[model samples]
Target: MFIRFLKENRYVSLLLTFLRLYLGWQWLHAGWGKISDGTFDASGFLNGAVKNMSGEHPSVQPWWGYFLKEVALPYVDLFNVLVPWGEFFVGLGLILGVFTSFSILMGLTMNFAYMFSGTTSTNPQMVLIGIFILIAGVNAGKIGLDHWFIPFFRRMLFKNTEKEFPQNI
Candidate 1:
């Protein structure tokens, strides 16, 4: 019942728009700060995550730390570019309601990555909001560009008979 309401209700979509805007702004600010500073480095964070695996509490799991140490740290240079730009693009996609599902999923992936690295901060809250947005599905972006863009693409991609596709597509 709750999921149905979230997926179909117009009022819920309004609420989701506000949530999307807030979450999108948060991501945009973080990314823009890193990009503008131009001194962003993931090596420090990756090393810290690996170090966190040794403490008594062991905030980061051993497997995750190993991955960070071996896979991530070795490609720190690529992360230097990917992280900031990925965040920026995810934020833009969410705000514009372009590829809304993909944006939320990518943002969640980043949130989980940060949490796995032992940094909590506001990631939990962001992840909760992102979950709500994802649950809302197409309705979450109905008021934005997805309203027009989705239908256009559907029409273009499914060009066939005179049959009309459902608006939910």
Candidate 2:
């Protein structure tokens, strides 16, 4: 039974692994460029260039500017420092297959927040990515470090018996 299930679902796992690696590389490359530049000061460029647009009005400011300003801006400097690093780490984790579930969850959460902000054309893309991550069950370790580390971590952190992998329908 287990062998049959694995055989049937093997393609799904492979697809997810490839998807994760591609998405991870895309994010990592973008974040790495930003990190290398070592400057988050887009205030003038953004306010000047993107503050006015026909379709969305403000394309430079991320979708969640209001939240970043009204809510998150109090610590805007801190956010500037953390956000790039967070993106890099998320990308790295996804590519390496380490903490794959958490990495996907974090990306999904961030993308959802952006989608809710009602500011960018990228919202649709973000939604699509989220759907892909969910459908792929990207957390189900396949050719990644999570296959080994997750079990050890689970055993160390939780006292409950390990759960069995669900059969593919």
Candidate 3:
């Protein structure tokens, strides 16, 4: 009953839309700062993460840290592009409610990544909000592009004659 209310109610959908916008704006601002700075470097962040890679209470997992140190730091340039642009795109998608579930998933991934790197700031709160939005599913995106595009996507992909698309799945 509680889950149904969250996923099927109009009022709840509206609330989620607002929450999506708020989270989107936060992401957009953070990404924009990096992009507009023209000299934003991810090396410092990566280095700091690598430093805390291993211990009894390490920030990052051991094996993952090895991958990060060996693969990521060696190619910091890619991340320099990926992080800022990734944040911007994720924010835009969430704000527009286009591919909302995917956007939220990406947002959650970034939140986890940040937390793993020992950057607590607002990541925990963001993760909670993201999970709620994720659970809300299509209703969370009903007011935006998902309403239109998802059906289009369904028609294009599924070619179902009996029903539009199964939102539950």
Candidate 4:
């Protein structure tokens, strides 16, 4: 019942619009800050996460730490580029409601990655809001660009369906 309300309610969609804007701004700010400074580095952060895996409680899991030390660290340059741009684009998408679901998923992915790296910060809060936005789905973007994009894309996708697929089949 609650899920249906979240997914279908018009009032809820308005509320979701607010949430999307907030999350979008948060992400955009963070990414823009990093991009503007031009000094954002993942090595120090990655090393810190790896170190956290050593303690008794282990804030970061061993597997995650290994991946960080091996995969992420070695490709820090790629991350250096990907992180800011990815965040920026995700934020832009959410803000514009261009691809709300994809934006939320990307945001959630980053949130979880941060949490796994032992940084609590606002990732949890963002994740919670993101999950709500995700659940709301198309309704979350109905007040934004998805209002037109969805229908447009739908027409484009199915416009030639009848001709493409044989009726006999």
Candidate 5:
């Protein structure tokens, strides 16, 4: 049964793996560039974007701007710090296939946030990527550290769970 599953899914797996690797590399490269550019103050950019959202010619201005100004700005600086790091880490995790489920979740969250920010152009692309990641479960791809680490992770986390282990085990 295990062998059959692997054999049948080989091509599908390869395709999804390729997509995952490509997306992961893209995200990682972008995030790495942002992190390395010390002059790129995320806080300033976020604040400026927020302010622009309130402007008449704003690129993206959702009704949430009011709430963002009132509630979000209070912690905007903190968000600035965490968001970039989150992007960097999530990209790294995806690329390495480590904590893949968590990484996908984070990517989805980020993509959704961007989508709803009144930016329709970016939303569609990000939404499609998020859907692909969710559907592919590309975390099970070949050439990933996850293949080596997931077993250890499962053992540590599900030590007492016999039924939950992979069927082949």
Candidate 6:
């Protein structure tokens, strides 16, 4: 019953759009700060996460800990570049509604990753918001750019003309 309302309602979309904007600004600011700052490195955070692995109530999953120790530590430079820019692009996508679903999903993925590393922070709240945005789907972006972009892309790819695309009524 509730699912029907979420899937069918207009109000839900408005709520999701609001949520998207809120989240977008957050991501954008964080990313932009990292970019503008003289120095920002993932090494310290990764080391802290690794140290958390030995405690009785380990915050990070052991597998994640291993990945951090081996792969991420080996290439902290790559993560240094990826995380900030990734956040910025995700925020831009959300703000523009260029790829609303994809952007929110990626944001949710990052939220989970941050949580796995044991820094709770605001990630849980962001995760919830991302989930709502994901559920809202097209309507979440109905008021934004995707309304025009998706259709245009579809027309271009599918040749959605009466003559080129056959009617199936």
Top lDDT hit: 1
Model 5: weakest 10-residue lDDT segment is 134-143
Superposed Cα deviation of residue 149, candidate 2 (Å): 1.4
Which portions of model 5 miss their true places by more than 4 Å? 1-8, 42-63, 120-123, 138-142, 161-169
**Per-residue lDDT of candidate 3, residues 1-169 (tens digit):** 9888989999999999999999999899999999999898888888888888777898787776777789888999998999999899989999999999999999999899888777899999999999999998888999999999878887777685766567574
> What digit string (tens of lDDT, one per residue) describes model 5 on residues 1-169?
6434542465755665665666677667766776788544544544554665755677556565655566567877666666667778877887787766577678778766655454455546655765655654533444477677767866887897775766332
Q: How far is candidate 4 from the true structure (C-alpha RMSD, Å)?
A: 4.0
Cα lDDT of model 4 by residue, 23-79, tens digit: 999988889988999999988999999999997799999999999998999999999
Error of 6 at 102 (Å): 0.8
Which residue runs of candidate 3 sit more than 4 Å off their true CA positions? 160-164
Which residue pairs clash in candidate 6? none
lDDT of 5 at 143: 46
Cα error of candidate 5 at position 110, Å: 0.9
Q: What is the lDDT of residue 74 in candidate 2?
A: 62
Q: Lowest lDDT 10-mer window, candidate 1? A: 160-169
- As for candidate 2, its clashing pairs are none
Candidate 6 lDDT at 92 equals 90
Clashes of 3: 0
Give per-residue CA lDDT, model 6, range 36-88, as digits (tens). 99498999999999998887788988999998999999999999999999899
Q: Which is the better candidate, 2 or 3, if ranked by lDDT?
A: 3
lDDT of 3 at 11: 96
lDDT value, residue 103 of candidate 4: 94
> Which digits, one per residue and each the tens of the lDDT, describe model 1 over residues 1-169?
9988988999999999999989888888889999999999999899999999987789999999999998999999999999999899889888998888889999999999999999999999999999999988899898789888888888887798688777664
TM-score of 3: 0.92
Candidate 1 yields a Cα-based lDDT of 0.91
lDDT measured at residue 113 in model 2 versus the true structure, 0 to 100: 51
**By TM-score, how accurate is candidate 4?**
0.94
lDDT of 5: 0.63
**What lDDT is obtained when candidate 3 is compared to the true structure?**
0.89
